[model samples]
Target: MTLLDIKDLSVTFNGTPPSPPVRAVDSVNLRLEAGETLAVVGESGSGKTVTALSLLGLNPPEPVCTTTGSLRLDGTDLRTLGDKEWRSVRGRRVAMVFQDPGTALNPLLTIGTQIADAVRAHERLTREQARQRTIEALEQARMPEPESRLRQYPHELSGGMRQRAAIALAIAARPKLLIADEPTTALDVAVQAEIMAMLRSLCVDLGMGLILITHDLGVVAEQADRVAVMYAGRVVESGPAAHVLKRPRMPYTQALLAATPRLDAAARTRLVSIEGQPPRLRDRAPGCSFAPRCPVAVDDCTAGVPPLAVFDGDHAAACLFADAPVELPAARPASAAASEPGPAPTTDGPSPLVEFDAVDLRYPVRSGALRRVTGHVHAVQGVSLRVEAGRTLALVGESGSGKTSLTKLLLRLERPSGGTVRYDGIDVTRPGPADLRRLQREVQVVFQNPYASLDPRLTVRRILAQPLRVHGLDSDEDVLVGLLRDVGLDSFALDRYPSAFSGGQRQRIAIARALALRPRLIVCDEAVSALDVSIQAQVLNLLADLQAEHGMAYLFITHDLAVVRSVAHRIAVMRHGRILEEGTAEDIYASPAHEYTRELLDRAPGRRDAPVAPRFSAAGDTGLSPTTTPASQHTNKERSPLWRR
Candidate 1:
């Protein structure tokens, strides 16, 4: 049976005078069967979230926002439901999981209280009954310790634990339909695998339909039964996951697949970046929204919007020439072919750019109202590593694995409890005032979220100029323009604030600021993890080009193994605050020595060797069979004792 059906749905936000109303979601159509999984994919502002919000009647009021057309759930028209009626349907029949659990979950309330409250809202359960239901929900979500996590607040839990708590809350009322928006965007690969597995299990056991909204194609390939590619507020393509991913009819879908980095691709391979940006909502043209960026677009494509043409089975695409033969770029070399040995590092070469000799970092653990010290949280253990000049060293690990702590030692943000940290042969662990100033100028960092890093109040010129002015360097217009040009931006961007630019553009601004002081070392801390695949390719290419031109070394820290394979020359696997394996990327990828390293590789989604289970059968069966080996069974083997602290 159809769990949810939407046809000719349009959402428009009203604008003030002199500005046209913005149609965020345009005449969209979608359907989901009970226990089926549908994935909605697009860039940041492509109407994915707006369409999901429309289902729950979460958009602005009638005057500020206008919604029209059919939205039905289980044969009932949802568009006609009033405020009180909608409230009853929200958590009982449907629930939504947001991208950032940090924002979705309440910070002041305990995990148990929040889940219990949600349970009590939809059912006439007593306090004890609600508490038991909350515990059951957490266990069903595969949380480590459902009973012990009741009193912990959101801030006390790790990223993965917090997300699991959010999932628990969403499922507390046993909603039949679940909508998850970028559920694992910020999680590590291992944790991401666990979450996806748990979600798949829930769909099978509870017979719930799932709508997954995300930009990560790998996760879609592994988990989604059907795919809907949205662009500029329209469904450009939709079909079975296998057919759409393997034989995409739309240019946009093909471009996205081509741009995604694969684990088998050769290192330093340039990714194909989509040329222009998506059309703005207010300035949307009459024809296809993607016509401006489509490679094979012609005059006819701009004449009128193309209808969704159905061809092979249920596969369909909205394009004038969906059957036309197009030439795709050649595939990158395989790992075996690209593993040819390069010049090996030797002691005779110039001194290492950065070195950590038996380093250790520990934070004092405190408790009670008086905040008395109990023990210590060993964030980093004795670890020795080296990054040669003009090279990229990837530090790979899961959350709470001490990856960030090592970077803190290198940046001198925290002094090590043991051993020495040397930068250009200078002892950086405890540098004097003069040496600290020099270190600051020579070492720069690009953070994970550009929106949080770049000041929203400042324009592009001011953001870039602030760094140069601090170092007493030239902050002239010519220099600023040159910086923008270096990162593939024009001078027109100088007057615009950070909010005006996309995620990729803001990251470019951050990189330009990092280059203002002519730093020799750049620390990219999960920089590209949050961006779309197409934008991620563009940023990675830009970073590679800049490094080649300036001969700068990079400490690229990330949990994305596929991305690490494409960029890093050397790999270091850290877990439980210790390095388990370190070697050349080729050697490590070919034959990993440690069990943890192999587990990380095996859990990475979208690998050719890994086979995905079929989500549905030929008889139109929507129910999926649970995996024989539950993901929770591996918890004890994968998790370390340190995580308990």
Candidate 2:
């Protein structure tokens, strides 16, 4: 049963004279069956979400947007549906799981109340009946302790859990089609897999059609049956997931494929990034939307729009050269990599950078008006480890595993309960305020969400320049412009507010600001997890080059093991606030001694020819290779793992 269909769909948003009406959804066509999954993959500003919003007639009419073309669901024309009729179809037949679950949920509402309300929205079920359905909904989403979580607010759950709750709500009415927009973007690899598995199972068991909107190819490869590769406002390619991925026809599709980290193959070279930003919706290109950055784009490509034509094996590509042989594009120019690096990624080192000695961190738990001392919860147990300089030390664990707490201790954000952190023979754990401040300058941080980390009211120039201002260095406007230019952001962008920039662009600005201090340490918290593959590689390569030049140390915190292998020189596997394994990246990747470490390595993204984690430390007896050791002596990789936790 073809469940939903859209043909010649065109949507436009009204704006000022200079700003052309946004051709957000330009002459698009789509079809979905009763039980199938279609992945709409693209970077930011690709009009993927715009098309999704159009499906439910949920797009706001403000600025007086216009929609033309046919939109039908189950042979019913949704465009002619009145407000009441449209609302009836929204949750009862078609549902949506929006991106950013944190913001999507209502803070004041309990999980049960929210789900119950949705169930009650369409049907008149008794309180007891509604409650039962809510519990079952949570269970269907695979959220643990569904009953207990019903009373919990959105804030009480972790990012992964919150998204699951949202899924539960979306599925409460048992819709025939589920539209998930970046649903798993906030989760770690293991958690992402868990979510994907649940969604796939739900589709099979319930005969539900799924429309997944995301930029991660791995996610699409795992869960999608059919893939729609979107560029600007058009679908560049559409076919079976395997066929589209294995033999992409369009130049943009090919680049996207080459750039994505493969789960089965070893990465042979630096990923090829399509240089330059995506085209604006208001400024539709005269020819191909991707021509500016496409390596294979010929002169004819610029003449007019290319129609998506049949290629092979149920695949269609808009590119005229879709039948051409597979060709890998040349590497983007060098200065381009540095000058245009979007986000400042915490670089990986090929050497050991940080060492811990008998480390223990505990926060005093107090209660009562008298503030009587309560039993202390050990955040980090007695732990000792070494982090190679210019290399990455990936810390993998769940939220409560005390990952951030341990990082705080290392950064001197909190004094350890008992232990020492040594950096190149300097004990920074108990450093004076002045030294600590200087240390902070060298150890910059790139947080998970760019919006929360960046001041919303501030312009790009002000944010990037503020770092230099605080350090009492390079205050000249030209210096700031040069810095912006170095990070692939144009000077014109400096004048715009952070709200105007996309997630990836804001992240780039964040990287540029971090570099303003020229620090030696960079602590990344889920850095590239939210970015597109092409851009993730661009940022990753920039970090690699910067590390080669500056010899900086990275304390990378992520749940994604794929990134660990790609960037880490050494890896310290953590579980339940304890380090499970510590070894050179090679040992961790090739011959993981600990079962936990092996489990994490197995769940990483690319499986074939995957770039094994960088080996910053040599492992003995195991015979695993190590990252290069510095010229200095006395530093041993075989040293005891006991330092400080």
Candidate 3:
């Protein structure tokens, strides 16, 4: 049965004077049937979420926004419904699951109360009846101890538990359609798989339609039945998951598949990054929105907008030359790979850039208003690692595995409770006033969440100039332009703010600011975790090129092991504030000696042979390999897995 139908739908948002009104969604058509999952794939600000929100009249109020076109649910047109009429359809017939559960659930209410309230809002149910229904909803969501969890608040639950509770609330009324917007984007790989499985099961058991909005193609491959590729507020491609994923006709879709770092890919394989950012909604380039970045773009591509042309069965693509033969940039001859230089060479007998010697960072667990120390929080314990000059030391672990604490120790954001931290052979554990200034000047950081890290009020030029001025370096226009150019950005970006740039461009700006002082050591804390695959590849390559030119050392921290193989010279696997295994990148990838490390590797998705965990070849074994020493030199004795309660 056709559960939902949308045709020629367009959403427009009003902008201030001097800027044209933005057409956030333009003439998009979609259809969903019962017991089917349709995945909408795109980067940030691509109108995926906006289109999802418009389905149930959840978009922003009028005076600033307008939505037009045909939208029907079960043969009834939703566009003709008034506010009061739509309320009956929402929550009872259609429901939504937001990206972040922490912010979605009310902290003042218990989990059970929220679910019960949702039940009561849509149906005629007493408190006791609602409570009973809530328990059943929680049970169906696959949440354990559903009865006991009823009284617990949002803060008392783990990240995974909170998301499950959110799902329970959404399904409380047994809505016919469910829209999950990046449901597992914030979850670990294992938990993500579990959630995806649960969602698929729910769709089958409930016999409901599902629209999943996400950027992770891996998740789509694992769960989605059909796929829609959106770009600049348009569906560029639509087809079965297998066909679109394996034989993408649109260049944008092909680029996304090529740029993603796969677990099965050989170690140090250079990711094929799409050259430019997506078109801005305000600008909305004429003809094809992807023409500027399309590798096979021709003059005909820019002549007019191409409608979605259907091909074999349900497959369709919005490209003027979808049927024409085209060669991908990455598929060029081996001579192209030979021209690019490898990773920066490390100096023999050189001083370590940053060293942590048996570091232990502990905090007192306070209770009551008197703030008595009841126990200690062991954030980092006996963690020892060496980051040599001009090399990348990747720190890989799950969330709350002390990755951030380790970086904090290196940044001196928190004083270590035990052991020492050395920088350039100087003991920086307890630096004096002048030493602190020197440490700050010599070390810098680029954080995750580029939008949050960058100041919204400051222009790009001022942000890059502030660091130089603070360090008493030249802050001239030439210096600013040089910084921008160093990170593959043009001078035109100098006048823009963070809001004007895409996530990838904002990260490049962040990298430029970090280089303003020419720091010897950089702490990149989950820098590319929130980016799209193509953007992540672009940023990773940019980091590599910059490191080779500047000879700077990097403490690259991330949970993405596939990305680690491409950039890290050494790999350290951490669990519960302790290092389980440490070795050269090649040795660890080929054979991890620790059980915890093996578990992490096994959980990685898209691996060809992952039973004993995927094995990656060392340098010189694949194309675009990063430079590395033989595995025998840096192998360390494996330690027993730490206890986690």
Best by lDDT: 1
Expressed as tens digits, the lDDT of each residue in 1-645 for candidate 3 is 888899999999987787689999999999998899999988766788889889889877786889999998889898888999888888998899886677689999999988998899888988999999999988876677899999899977755578788988998899989999867644555556666777788789988889998767777776788999999999999989887876677878876776677665555555666665677688877899988777556688788899999887999999976775233433211122222334434465556778899999997867789999999988899999999877789998866678778888778788899999898777777778888899999899987656667999999989988877887878877778866755556788899989877555687788778867877788988666656777677567656654554566789887677778777878998877999899988889889999888887777655542211111222123212233221111112210010000
* Tens-digit lDDT string for candidate 1 (1-645): 889999999999998877789999999999999888999988767889899999888999878999998999888898999999999999889899876677788999999999999888899999999999999999877787799899889988766678788988998898988999877766788988988888888888888999999877889999999999999999999999887887777878876787787787666566555655667789889898887766666789889999999879899999876776343342243232122223445777757889999999999978899999999989999999998777889999887788878998998789999989999888997778888888999899987657578999999999988877887978888788866755546687899899877655687788778877878899988877767776676567656654554567889988788889877879999998999999988888899999999999998988753222212121122111231221111232232121111
Which has the higher TM-score value, candidate number 1 or candidate number 2? 1
Give the TM-score ranking, best first: 1, 2, 3
Model 1 ranges with Cα > 4 A deviation: 330-347, 449-462, 473-518, 609-645
Candidate 2 global lDDT: 0.72
TM-score of 3: 0.82
Candidate 3's C-alpha runs over 4 A off are 84-175, 329-349, 368-371, 426-428, 456-462, 474-512, 609-645
Give a tens-digit lDDT track for model 2, residues 470-583. 878765766677556444566778788988776666777787777678777788877776677777766666566566545666788887665565566667877666888887
**Local distance difference test values of all predictions, in order:** 0.80, 0.72, 0.76
lDDT for model 3, on a 0 to 1 scale?
Answer: 0.76
Which model is ahead, 1 or 3, in terms of TM-score?
A: 1
Cα TM-score per model: 0.87, 0.84, 0.82
